[model samples]
Target: MQKVTLRFSHNNPSCLPDYRNHSRSLKKVLQELNIPTWQRKRIPFLYYDDELVAAIGFFVCQAYVLQESEPSLHITWAS
Candidate 1:
């Protein structure tokens, strides 16, 4: 069976490449969003079979994004 997971971690650094094909600093992204330091660690990360797909409020990884006409999983995060 295929497995998809949503997990939260405070240690995911920017070394992971983003959908844009470049490394994005999670720290900077959070700061830009005005997410207070205290709340940054509470953000969730979406993973697909162990690959990082998204950093909840920030961005989704390229390999996991859906193309036009493709089936997709709709996700929502509630505070």
Candidate 2:
């Protein structure tokens, strides 16, 4: 398969179907952001390696992103 450095976005994650993992991501976002139920409905999702392991902001959730010459990407965030 070809390697791609997905410019991860809530509008588009460029990944495959993974509902269970995606749900977990929703939970994480809810817990992390402490957003209300209505607001929680708004935050989009992205899947990294078949898992919801990252978060991105609409205007800005993901703060730092580091890339290597590999398919793997490191995403970080801080309050």
Cand. 1 Cα-lDDT:
0.69
| TM-score of each candidate structure, all chains considered together | 0.65, 0.35
- Candidate 1 Cα misplacement greater than 4 A, ranges: 10-19, 24-36
Note the clash tally of each candidate.
0, 2
> With candidate 2 superimposed using the best TM-score fit, by how many Å does residue 63's alpha carbon deviate from the native?
14
Which of the numbered candidates is closest to the native, going by highest lDDT? 1
Whole-model lDDT per candidate: 0.69, 0.40
lDDT for predicted candidate 2 compared with the true structure: 0.40
Q: Kindly report the root-mean-square deviation of model 1 from the true structure over all alpha carbons.
A: 3.0
Model 1 collision count: 0
Off by over 4 Å in 2: 1-29, 58-79
